[model samples]
Target: MSNEIINIIADRPFNEAVQDKYFERVEAQLTEVFARPRLRSFAKSGGVLAGRAAETIDASVVGPSLVVFEERLSEDDKQDALDSQAFAEAVVNKLPAETSQEQRYMAYNEALSAIGWVTESYTYKKYDSKKLTLTMNDALLQVLETVISAGSGNVLSLVAAGFDKLKGDKEALKIVDAGSKESSVVSFKAVPCIVAPGGGMAMVMGGLDVFSKDYDGDFLFFTFKTEGVHLFQAAGIRKFNKRAFDRKRQQVYNYIDQFGDGLFKKIAG
Candidate 1:
């Protein structure tokens, strides 16, 4: 099934008919998955809170394709959703209409690589504040240590000063204390940092209270009332794109899982 779809997309002047067929195949697969009795029961019981289970499944299946689809949209068009046919057309529509075929091919390959990363490594989990503290502390310590090892003495001093301030700030202390006591709950999402060409991975920790200086890489942005953390890696920085956020956010309640401790250890060590 996958090979057939790949072959269809490999042709130059990408065929809309073939793309439609690909979407149909994906839709069919999702439909079957959602039809399972257990999933249906869960969905009916409000286990899937962000709209219907079908929509969640749709988003997860088509999410990767949007990486390619969105790159072609104009500012105005980006505000609207594109149908499968329209998306197919956009895939072949190189901006400026004069882009060389070689450049177009390179863009196509990059999109393919990005999509592969998401499909293969994206994950979701739910954790209590105690667990979250351990995870966040490890990640923060690693980042700080990395900077120190690089001999960025001035930056290290600045970051250490910031950390000291965070420890004293009443609001910051409240969150840290709450998380340390396991009184808070959190939803976590991790995916390959596709937006950043060389980034290892990006994480979003919903309900986790963190100071600005707590993170050292790229940048960290915040959102209010968001169901899950949305981190979109593009160019050299990570940003929030709610529309492309997790479709599996609701499933977090069903699982108690550890974040990428091994990955962190490997990088930190």
Candidate 2:
């Protein structure tokens, strides 16, 4: 009889804690963005769309089960969360005299901090003779905008465009019949190579592992009416501000170069 070796532990080079924290941050922001009523309906309807493989996250639609998670946060439920976030920022600006509930307040506080954005309330903190002004550091505020615009210009624009299209077609997207389902696709990467060999959109679905690492994607489905699907890169070029993207990319690279101390190599995605 042959003996088998025991399980081997794998090396994890990346900081898992940092990764998880960022994932939560990204997921929360996406959820808030998708809570827009029109998007909620498009996602929940489980519509289909033509798409190509080309990014960190592939087609707008992926596995079937994601529709369930997409449906979990109803518009009314998510609105409460958004309102709480705004209220938390308001409270910070107001500087209430006493500390509030530890858990709830901590969550809201963390959410705002994660965004690194702050609006300075005109109200001042007065000391008998003088008033003190507090706000997000002006320099840091610019950095925040750089990071946000980088994301918004690239990935977020595609998302926003998809939802905008879905909103227009809501009346037609019931998702019950096969005919409607076939018409729901988002058509992500529409290139000559993808269309050649008669594979079309179906070819993209087969090689999906190349495009998306995530098992479930962020969309449902759809057909087009003057809304031609294009390459995310091409779309990014058209819809996003190139100067802004370059600036942000440079800023990020500069940060790593200045402080990496040889520990950091590069940023991948």
Candidate 3:
């Protein structure tokens, strides 16, 4: 006799309840991860501000298909991550609220590209404030100057003698006048811009355990446990931000949008 696949028990259908449970687990994991002292210290050292992670849930699929749940870093955290590593404060020129979303996104991309930075997964909410604030360490002034002189167009200038004068001046200087000529914006790429140790954990899914051989006639009962190591002081740095995860989620959304509900229905049914 062949073994039968057992379904997990839940108050609702297996598919619906499983998603809720998964998200609940994820939320608990994130809360624990953020509360760790080592992670908080690492973020503080990198000048990155800590913010709440917001969950984005998608349940458009019908039938037995898997649901998607995402926990993305807050916008404030993303902005802080970018500004923390910047060589100088970015001058932001605010655009009117009437400005079209496409126009704003395009403008921000163009401005960042002018400075040799490539952005990924640009969103309206990410740059909608129209204020790009980049604060760099005083020690990187020369490096900033080199980058500015090499490729930055009229968009960036260092006042009199470039960043050299601002090296020991102790006064903050704006490198890129994003609002001087035209409206521009700035943001970091969708990568692990913030580096920190013990910022990540590896999840392991255990084998399913059978709860009952027979339930409600044809239905069988079973459950599986997922485990992960919550390392507080591990070696090396990891990309603590969920930008990459967000990008993948966006790709899935795009696929679903392009293919329509029929595609999911076919797979689920």
Number of the top lDDT candidate:
1
lDDT of 1 by residue, 25-57 (tens): 334434443333332211233322224423211
Reference-based lDDT, residue 254, model 1: 20
List clash counts for every candidate, in order.
2, 15, 0
Instruction: Write one digit per residue (lDDT tens) for candidate 2, span 1-269.
Output: 12321211222233435435744644443444323222121111211111211212211221110010112333432222222223233333233334322232333333332332121111111111111221111111222222233433333333334333433443312221111133222212110001112221101000000111111322223211212211111110011112222222322222222222212111111
* Local accuracy by lDDT, each model: 0.25, 0.23, 0.23
Q: How close is candidate 1 to the true structure, as a TM-score?
A: 0.20
After superposition, the stretches of candidate 3 with alpha carbons farther than 4 Å from their true spots are: 1-81, 84-93, 119-269
| 56: Cα error in model 1, Å | 34
Instruction: Please identify model 1 stretches exceeding 4 Å from their true place.
Output: 1-139, 143-162, 182-242, 246-269
The 10-residue segment with the lowest total lDDT in model 2: 201-210
Candidate 3: count the clashes. Answer: 0
Model 1, CA-based lDDT: 0.25
Model 2 error, position 112 (Å): 5.7
Q: Which candidate is the best by TM-score?
A: 1
